[model samples]
Target: MEDRELLDQLFSGGDASASAWRAFLQKYSNLFLKIIWQFEKDRDEVMEKYVSVCSRLMGNDFAVLRKFPKELGLKSSDFPSWLVAVVRNISVDLHRHSQGRRRYPKALLRLDPIDRKIFDLYYWQGYSLEEIGHQLDLRKNGKGTDVNESFARILRMLTRYAPRERKATFPTSVPFNENMFVPDEEEPRVDVALFDKWLEGLPAEHRLVVRMRFWEDMSAVRIARILKIVPQHRVYAILQKSLQKLRTHVERNMASN
Candidate 1:
């Protein structure tokens, strides 16, 4: 069926299980799958996100389809671009949620500036030895040490200070009005584990900016240069987004548990 016909059937408020819906998905499934694969390379991960995108599109009586501007009289050719945009957004959300479940070791927090940058670029950003070497000016046959040796040393340091699981207890006592305004008697310890958990929830670029700024103590100008971001303002914007995600996650966890 043509895109307009399928869209007309969808918005006609008729039965959703009609052939129009099936035809729509059949025609667009490949496009959506391609966009999903762009975000996730693994076969399993790609399939999972594709299924999620389908579910979302089909949910609420085809709510997403209903959002389309039918008045504009969209053509069949326009459908692919529209569908790609939708699928890409869904894939990004899925990727972010998946990343959120991971937690970096607290040992990463203690690394010195250079080692930390090497580890973050290599592991967190998935940069290769050569790429990292180029970015950090650690190119072999130059003034600096070999990238491979530096990376191995960072790995050894991480292993040496590997994080150990520990349980923490917080007071449950409720303070009255006067003491409520005052600080707790005991100093509140920073929960590196919890912080790491929140950090993982951030999008890849956002996490990179946050780590560079706070963990690596690099200026935004330096971060923009290292990350190859065009403008310094983008680094600030990413930091804002990252902090907002972390704050929201903390609030949700507090409410849930």
Candidate 2:
């Protein structure tokens, strides 16, 4: 069925609604499992989280599914990106908040629940301060939760555990993983065999350009100069095509699961 037709069927409040929900579940189950697998290797844990995700979408008269305001200029082709986004959020929150708490500094542990959640969202989940500020501003009686002040206070509390360097506290300028906020778990996000499988499929030129561009951090112009290509625009074109193909290959693998 078309995207609009499927959505209409879901909200039609008619007999087909039941079947529509089932169909939706069936269609997206692979995507759901694929996303959850990024955070867990244990089959049982993955299944448990997968079930939790479906329940969250279907619960409360399907409130979460209905929350998408497709009327706000959303196109049909956007469905996959939107679905991936919402499902990714559900998976992340499930693993972070609902499944189990990661080891945190005792100082952060002593903070109240909201404070801890804020810290986790910022420190571990890598939410921007502005995002957290806006989020807290939406909550009831959350007017006092100034993100800067709270983060400053949390830093003071956690200072003892931080390294001697000044950037031990997460700074806005640095990348998320470059700091101490990286998750303790070593997530096997990809199967090396499968990864090599995709890499092996790439054309030799595309593979060489990808390695130079990413691994060596070479600019398109530099890559062109190095490879003795006449015009640099061709390098840009090749890089774009290579990335598109790589993304397509990865998504194909995910959907197959």
Q: Pick the candidate with the highest lDDT.
A: 1
Error of 1 at 59 (Å): 1.2
lDDT of 2: 0.63
Q: TM-score per candidate, in order?
A: 0.37, 0.40
Stretches of model 1 off by over 4 angstroms after superposition: 13-17, 70-76, 97-257
Per-residue lDDT of 158-216 in model 2, one digit per residue for the tens? 32222222222333332223222334344212235543565588888877776666434
For candidate 2, give the lDDT of residue 151. Answer: 71
| Count of backbone collisions within predicted model 2 | 0
The TM-score, computed over Cα atoms with residue i paired to residue i, of candidate 2 is 0.40
Per-candidate Cα RMSD to the true structure, in Å, reads 17.3, 22.0
lDDT of 1 by residue, 1-257 (tens): 77767877876766744777778878888888888887787999888888899889878988887766563776667776777777787788888854543333344544544555665555444466787777765643554556687676654433222222312222233212231122324332345655688778887887777776655546666778888998667776676566556556665665687
